[model samples]
Target chain A: MRPVFLIVLALISQASLADSPPLERQQALLELLHQDCGSCHGMTLQGGLGPALLPSALEGKSALMLTATILQGRPGTAMPPWSSLLTQQEAEWLVTQLKQPAPPQDANRH
Target chain B: MRNQNLNNFRYFLVCLMATVFLVSLPRAPLADVRGTGDLGLVVERTSGSLTAINSTTRRAVGKITGLGDLSHASLVYSPDERYAFVFGRDGALTKVDVLENKIVKRVEQAHNSVGGAISQDGRLIATSNYDPGGVRVFSADTLEKVADIKAEYGDGQLAKVVGLVDAPGQKFVFSLFEAGEIWTADLHDPKNPKIQKFKAGKEPYDALISPEGRYYIAGLFGEDGLALLDLWNSDAGIRKIVPEYAKNDPKLPVFKMPHLEGRALVGDYWFLPAVGHHEMLVIDRREWKVVRRIPLDGQPVFVIPRPDERQIWVNFALPDNDKLQVIDTRDLSVVQRLTPGKAVLHMEFTPKGQEVWVSARDDDQVLVYDTETFREMARIPAEKPSGIFFTARAHRLGL
Candidate 1:
């Protein structure tokens, strides 16, 4: 029964990932994560007023947990929640990008 | 004898080249550049320094350097509009000669500061500081320190000052960020000013005196309301308005502090950015009531109306920072939506309301638009330009 539950959970997560926003919207969200998020988290995500978002900094941190934090900002801090601007699935996708090796090319392009 | 002749010939050739080089130079001499401040313009490069442009010709005049930490710098023009007082993020107050495109005098008044205000009489300049938590007044001409009044609140704790502006009666008004109080200092006696104080809202981020210099409204960060003061009637005390604004509603976290200057008064109603929400809260200025809430593309950052009050333009915080919304004053509705490139930091309308200039930070360009046609007219390249200020701003009160 436990094995079956694990399989169902894996399938649900896959379905959510497949529901990612259209290419155009996904692209815009990536820009927001880099520039807007960079305003506090640092342009390069190495950390300034906010904590670093680099993969190295996010190493021991779980992707799901970071997604929750992105959707619901930490209270009593300057880190604002992006849930109003981003969908939960989109937030999850962004967390994945945040843990990637490098920021998107156009993030710094303009 | 032959070698001497050769040396003289070489010297003659060198002098000819030197004369040609000096003659080829284009910009006017420092002495000649004086008194042309009316023709001057400055675009603050967040990186550092200012690129001086001829406001009349729309051409880059020259670059003025050695200004420290321009990341959050603000400017105030002199009475003749011949000079600019630049308040740097590092608390450096620099008096720049607009005509000569040079910094005349610079003094590090505080460890850190946000911005400053010039006295109405143009006799003094005051800076609102973050570090050491106080304000310092200096003489406009000599750049000499006049007074250092600490923003002290309960239990002798010093507080950072914000929303500083010059009142009509030779007084400087500012609010304390930490202590949550408003204070006024009369510069009648420059060395020792008579200070007046009042308790205001919690975490008042910034304040703006009305265009007519009647009301001083400060938006709070710690709470959901504003502190309003009538300059004409100081004894009336500071009253709280827009109470419980977005308090019960599930809202997003405030990413950036909305400026005090963006509250646009379209006749009777003021369209202000609703903190942490995708809406511009409309309040009837007479009753101080939240009469309406106009939905926006994102968190509204800057709210500026045309000089004629025909249209009100707004920019947002993030993700939607690329979009701009314009509201018609006649019907009080969004008239146009503009995508002027990414990270639009600031905008300024023409003196006569012909065009509005917007700074696209990421693109490093100043996008100009024809207000009537609502069309992009020109794009002038700049170096990380954030603020595009006209000398005309000097004429306005509590600007």
Candidate 2:
């Protein structure tokens, strides 16, 4: 019974790990966030044509809702759907990153 | 002994003459002394540097670094074509001397700025800002604040300004993005500007002045039309052109907003990029009617004409960003297609328009091509370059 319980626990952990994007893909997503998204929402995510995505600006916003917006996109606006490029889990991860404080290193730094 | 002394005296006289001639001639401070007319600047966006290149030499002459946030940078040259005022995304306006290849003066004028323009006389420089939304004008020489025209509208709220361009009669014209209006600040009296406002279409994203500086057209992002203001006829108000050109078709996602500056006005037809569509709209400038819609591969970013106006070159947004298509003005058809490099950003032709320089950001190079033969002439190494502005832009009415 103990061996069976340990196998089930290992299976659950593996399933959760599969939900998150790999480290390499995360780096690419970050680049897209800074460069492509930065085209409209300033390079530092301070805002341009799009609104600011800083932690202060995104305060109290639902991460799930933001993830949905990222995947489905807002209609009648310049923000287009990224569902073709990003998965639900990946979109959620991007939202989590956006909600947190920006990293110390400059996005434009080579 | 007497002959030897005479020969030595003659040699001494020749040496004295040579020294006098060398001292009398004007001393050059630098080894390479050249005019700024043939020189241009390429904005190294990611690195925050400007690569000053000589179009005549087809090589980078110098790199001016330390201008902050050049991700969406643009520059305008002084009337003398010696100094270039670079506007950074972080709202820093840097005055760089192309001849000396250094920053002469830099001022952090706003929190976020888009682009700038120099006055007709080139005495004042005006920057369009997104944050604190207004147009700030400064003295071209000292970068001192000359006038600050706030884009206040609808219950005293500030709106972001875009498409700032210099018009005739010491005027600076720009479009209000949020307020959906166009304003002309007549700085004939720099301290006290006579502001004139015109109600334009919804979401005027960017604007461009005609080559003759008579028409100021703002491209609307929210609608399928453009706001046309005849600077020559100010009392007529704004007119909408090509309304509902895309009414039948669904709008596609625009990864990048199409830039309207330096648009192609070949002969009587005005070639413009249709937003959210892989097409170029040919409009008759005389009647302001859509003449033809040339289908393209992707959403067009810049539809610029070669100096000779024989051909129109176009670059696209993401997915098709690597491709560049050339259209023949005679038949208005896609004449040639070439994959220059990855993420092709901007292009600038030589003063006379013999060769064109294209910046490919991902490739980290600026490729030069011969206009007539359509062959690669040279490749310049750059660090994520974007805008390429030649000093010749100084002479053009609206660049």
- Evaluate all candidate structures by whole-model CA lDDT and list the values in order: 0.78, 0.87
lDDT tens readout by residue for model 1, B272-359: 8887788888889888999988888888888888888888899988768888999887877888999998888788876777888887
lDDT of 2 by residue, A12-69 (tens): 3543475668867777777778767888887777788789888899899998889988
lDDT of 2 by residue, B192-253 (tens): 99999999978888899999899999988777778999999999999988784452234776
CA lDDT of A24 in candidate 2?
73
Model number with the top DockQ: 2
For residues A1-110, write the lDDT of model 1, one tens digit per residue: 89877865664455347677776777787666655675556445555335668878899999888988988887755567778788998988777666655444443342
Question: Where does candidate 1 clash, by residue pair?
Answer: none
Cα error, candidate 2, residue B125 (Å) = 0.2
User: Total clashes, candidate 1?
Assistant: 0
* Deviating ranges (above 4 Å) for candidate 2: A1-18, A104-108, B1-25, B246-249
